[model samples]
Target: MLYFEQLLVNGLMLGAVYALAAVAYTLVYGVVKLVNFAFGELFMLGAFITLSLMAPEISLLGHVVPMPGLSFHAAAPLAIAAVAALGALIDRVAYRPLRNAPRLAPLITSIAVSVLLQSLAQTVWGPGSLRFPDTPLSQIPAVHLGQVSISGSNLVVICAALVAMAGLQCFVRFSSLGRAMRAAAQDTTAACLVGIPVNRIIGLAFVLGSGCAAIAGILYAQAFEFASPTMGFTPGLKALTAAVLGGIGSVPGAAVGGLFLGIAESLCAGFLPNGAVYQDALSFILLVLLLLVRPQGILGKKEMNSHARGSLITAKARKRASMVTAPLRAMDRLFASRFFDSWTFRLLVLACSIAAGLLVQSDYWLSIMIVVLVYGMLASGLNIVVGFAGLLDLGFVAFWAVGSYFTSIVFIDVLQKQFGIDVDSVWWLLYANLILGGALAAVCGAILGYPTLRVRGDYLAIMTLGFGEIIRVVATNWVSLTNGPMGIRGIPSPSLFGYEIGDSRSLYFFALALTVVLLFCIGRVVRSFVGRAWVALREDEDAAQAMGVPGTRYKLLAYACSGFVGGVVGVFYAHFQQYISPASFSLFENILILMLIVLGGLGTMIGPFIGAAIWIVFLQLSLKVPFVNSYPESRYILLGAMLIALMLFRPSGVAAKARLRLVMEGV
Candidate 1:
């Protein structure tokens, strides 16, 4: 009874924190219909800022501040202010310019913003956990009620959450600016017509949301006692889930959903076998079930549902109707011309590029090249789902993990145990694993898509994220198959007809060949009729269905294709590293993949490749640079600053124009 009571109290407190974070996500989505993938990073940034200010060694005015004085407690409020400012900045920079662009443009920008922030945090914070300075606030005594005891920190967290939520409610319900925000959320055009500053309201929403998140971060750090650059990923994902579960656009709903998720996760951890380890999985399961039953969320208005569905239909119809017969007419004209004769020159250029890569004998360069190609494949696959299909999938790494685990399991069991295959031959296992892994990934993709296609936008993203966490949990705890956290080892490399490709030179050619094939296939699909249907659905779902475009089928196809490619890459990754672990497929990995796709340009064939190249080069260079690597923590600061600048200056991404042209050209 005591344990249960304590668990309940802790759960509720945790839920309160989640609720606070969810409010930020909900506010952004309420007005803009965007998931704000970077929202989590905002919270992360807040925590880091607090840590920086409170650290005893760090002096603000060229003098060290003694512990537990005004400087220590002041860190919390200052952090909140800084994060709020950043939130408004994010709106003015990343989202404002892309307001009228395609849905994918903003979605990609959010992802880039997320990566840029995380990377910057890493650079500044030194990639390691930072402990907050001990203060009297943290040393407050615990309170006991009957058999259950609650710590001062938890009590403070709960009380602070309630106060913040209450304040927000009052502001929205009674204040003029709050009314303006509500008006904008209800209808942006109407709000504008009424002379409400819609853009400013949007920015205010971000600021308010960010403030809440920052406070939550400070409270969470107090409770958890440790902070890191990557800490935001899980909480961010959960907060998004909570926002959707409670009705994404509703302020009260977000609060309710956060509490529900936190409590459920706590209870699951307490009661289930290996519950502590599988807690994340249980939370996701609850989210998926909740979405399946109540897609609109617990406190959401019913009117929003019809509006969402109608918008999807209208967009799909417009995009499909505009493109029908146009592509066919162009194809007929091209067939009568000398377009085919140009293929010989294209092939020659491709051959020359391949030769150039092979001639470079530097193993280090080859390894980097392989990584870039693999990421390109992953990014391209993600683009099909997010860019063309307009689904915000944050669990892409699930497919990657699925592929890797599948290959590892198969190689360990079937090839070695039953067939008496040589495990030492890393090359043969690589090819076989990739083929089998892709098939398994497609199957998983279909499974995830079947139920989720009914949900759109933020709801879809949240559900998929839950599904991804479930996969990770299973991988972590399924000791019999996955070896638990011990991870899988001795995975092999690619082989062709029994010829080993373990050498750097051989692997380079193998990876390059696969990348070219994959890129070509992606290009062909994007140019095909099916690809047009995907774009039409992305633009407007209901319209596409009206045009006989089978929205669900096409969505499933995108998932399957993306999953297959992710799986293939996973197989390559497993063999390349000769090891696979649950940590590799965490939510951070998913964010990184999304970053590559978005930063490069979603919906463009060359976008992922270019994005991957830049990311790999940046990562390698950052690690080698004396200024960045020397400090360890400075990289995160640089990465965060860069992301903020990018959002402010180029929300459309570096390759946005080119990607838009490619998609428009196909149309």
Candidate 2:
């Protein structure tokens, strides 16, 4: 009884911190309807700023000046102010210009911003978690309540949270600026017409939300007595879950949702076996469940189901669309006059590239080509979802991970543990694994897609992300099956008719062959009825549904096909590397894959090939360069900058070819 009581008290206090962060997400989402993926980074930034400010002395441009450290009270306000300014700056730099662009543009920018900020923090903080200085505040005594004692810091956190919530409620209700914010959130055009300064109001939303995040950070740091660059990500995600659970866009809903999430997490962790290891997974599970049940959120008034598939058909997209189609029109004229059509020409080009790769006798170059081919295949598969189906899947790595683990289990565990057969004796299992692994991944994909595909836009993206994280968490914790973080090793190399493919050169040729087969198969599918249905769904889900297209069926089909490709590639990866590890299949890898497809051309058939080549080659060459090798992290920073630049200037991508045939017309 005492333990339960203690859990309740702890849950409420933790919920207070989560509530503060949740409000930040709600406030911004309420007005602009943007997810602000980088918001967590702002929370992290605020904590660091407070830490720096509380330092005994500050250094500027190689000069250090003696200074007295400020108390928590003084540092908290300063950090809030600093972070608020940074939030406003972020809006101006990353979000503002892309306001009227395609919805995906801003979301992608947010991701890039998130990466940039995280990378910057890593570089600044030296990749180490930090602890607050042993200050006067942290040493305060605890308050006991019938064996449910609360620390002084936690009490302060709860009190401060209540005050902040009350203050926000009062300000929003009575202040002129608050009214202006509400007006703008309701109807930006109307607010603009009424001279409400919609732009400034939007900026203010970011500012105020950032301030709340600052408070959340300070309180979190205070209670925990430690801070880290990544400390904000999990909490930020939980807070978003709380915001959505409470009813996004509703202040009161966010508060209740936070408490609910916190208590649920606390109880689950306390009572369940190995619950502490899986605590992070709880938030994502809640998010998916809530999105399925009530996408409007618990208290949300509006549906908040903004679709993105066809939303990109704005003026900018049309302009890009025309540019995308121009080369096709020219090709049509050329193909009409020439001996072969565009399709035949493309086949010939592919054949030539394969022949050239085959002609390369050097093992090193073949090894490099193997990576290019693998990523290209992965990118192509992903393009089917993001570029053709118009689903922004951040969890594509989940499929890859699934495929890899399935194959590893079959070859390593099943062979060794169950059958008691040496892996080397069952070289033929590789073929079976390839077929079975892909089938399993397809099944998993169907399951993942079935529930969340119904949700629209960023909601779907977030849900998929959660699904991906869940897969990783399960893989990390389910040690009996996945071998935990140590990963699987000593897997036998794949062989054909007892001929071992142990050489890098042989693997390269093998990977290239698989790549060719998969690309051909995928290309044919893209030109088939199934592909047209996917394009129809992407262009407009409701309209497609009206036209007798099963939105659910096509989506599941996309996932299955994409997952099949991912799974097959995973098998190839496992054999090629002769090992498998969870670390290889991370969220960052998913982002990198997305970058490949986007940088290449979203829906273009040839885009993945070009994009993968450029990215892989750049990475390989960058490491060999002296200056670049000195600053390894600069590559990601540059990539982030490139994403921002691409979104702003050329949203169509580099290889956005004009299609001669329309997939929507069953071409």
Candidate 3:
């Protein structure tokens, strides 16, 4: 009984924090009918800002409080306010312009914003975790009442959350602006028919949501005691789930969903054996169950917008056409054009490039290059889903890991030991493994897509993210197959006809060749009928459907294609590295891959390649630079600042519109 009570208290405290984030998500969805994929990053920024402010030398007001002595009461409110401001700024810059665009445009913009923000944070904070000073509230002794012990911080968190919710409820009900905002949420045109300033109200909603997120961030810091560049993901995803569970556009529903989710997660983690490892999976199980039972959410009302709906159908047809024919056209044009008219010249250039790379000679540098190629492949695969199909996939790395593990099991376990096959000659294994990997990932994709395709925008992003976590959890805890965190090792490198390509120079060429081939294949697909369908779906799902495009079929195709690419890349990744581990394919990997696609330019052929090159080069350069490497913790600060600047100046991407126009002209 006492244990249950403690669990309830802990769950409620955690739920309060989730509620704060969920409210932000709900508000944005309510106003614009779009999910802010970057919402979690905003919460992360809030916590980091608080940590930076509370750092040793910073002074609040006229007096300086020693960093070691910073109190929760002092830091929490300020952090919340700072995060709120940042959130509003994100809206002003990234979201506001794209508001009038198709739903996919804003959704893509949100993803880019997320990538830019996360990268900026990583640069400034140095990709390392920071520990905030433990506050007085945490130090307070726990209060014991009837076999239940509640810590002071937990109680404070719960009370503060309730108060915040109540305050919001009152403002929305009684304040003039709040009423206007509600009117806008219900129907923007109807609200505009009155005197409500829809845009301003929308901005205000963002501000309010951001502020709530900030509070949640501080509360989370107090509870967790550590903050990292990537910390926002788990909580952000959970909050999104909460919002969906309660009905995304309903404020009261979000609060209820958050609390319920928290309690459910707590019960699963605290009571189930191996629950800690499986906690992530439990969230998805619940999400799938809920979605299957209630497609619109517990409290949501379905009101389809005709314009948005029509757009989706048209978009779907275009995507389908592109998928089927684009690849062949691209290949034919490449061969016929002056750019690749001479195979001899291309071969000569490749030979020289390989020679030059070999002469420079650092295994570390070679390894980095290999890593870049691997990422390039992963980014390319993700582009099919996120760029072409117009889906925001937060857990793409899960498929990458799937391919790696599949190869490992087949080559190391079945072929080598059982069949007495020579592990050294693994090239044949790779070919077979890649095919199998793609198939497996496609199956997983179909499974994830079946339920999620009904929901568009942010809901899809969150569901995919939850699915990714479930895969990771299974990988971590399925001791019989995965070896349970011990990870699979001693995987052999690729060997073609008994010639090993494990040598750095040899592998570089091999990887380069594969990247080129994959790029060609992907480029072709992008110009095909299927690719056009994806773009159409992305641009406007309803419109695409109305044009006789089958939404479910096209979406499932995207999932399968994306999974296939991811699986192929995964097979190569395993053989290239000759090692397989769960850690290599965590949520961070997902973020990095997403960043490449967005920073380079989503839905473009050359964008991911450029993005991968820049990211890899910068990462290597950061290591060499004394200032960056010396204070690793501060790197994310620079990254965060850069992201803010990038979004402010180049919302589309680094590539100029003229360049894309030229490419289109060539095509």
Q: Against the unseen true structure, what C-alpha lDDT does each candidate score?
A: 0.77, 0.80, 0.74
User: What's the ranking of the predictions by TM-score, best on top?
Assistant: 2, 1, 3
Residue-wise C-alpha lDDT for candidate 2, range 68-139, written one tens digit per residue: 588767887898999999899988888888777766777778878887877677655645677765556667
**Deviation in Å, model 1, residue 1 alpha carbon:** 2.4
Where does model 2 exceed 4 Å of error?
57-69, 306-309, 312-341, 348-352, 355-366, 624-628, 658-667
Worst 10 residues of 1 by lDDT: 311-320
Q: By lDDT, highest first, what's the ranking?
A: 2, 1, 3
- Least lDDT summed over 10 consecutive residues: which range in candidate 3? 311-320
Give a tens-digit lDDT track for model 3, residues 374-441.
Answer: 78788888878877777778878888888999999998878877799888755676778878997898
> Candidate 1: misplaced stretches above 4 Å?
51-56, 59-73, 303-342, 413-421, 424-430, 621-625, 629-667
Q: How much is the lDDT of residue 295 in candidate 1?
A: 77
RMSD of each: 5.7, 3.8, 6.4
Per-model TM values vs. the true structure: 0.87, 0.91, 0.82
Q: Pick the candidate with the highest lDDT.
A: 2
Q: Tens digit of lDDT per residue, candidate 1, span 1-667?
A: 8888888998999999999999888887888888887888888887778777766564322345444334656887888999999989878876787676545556656776777777666654556787766756678899989878898888988998988988998999899988898899999999999899899999999899889888888778778988887888888888988887898889899999999999988888889888888887776888888778877889987654432442221122112222533443453453334442356744874796588676888899888888888888899888889877767787888899989898888888677776888866544656666778988898899898888966766667778878888998899899989988999887766667777678877877778888888777877887788888888877667777889998888889999999988998898888888899999998767877776766666666656877788878877788787866565545545555554444344443455444532234345
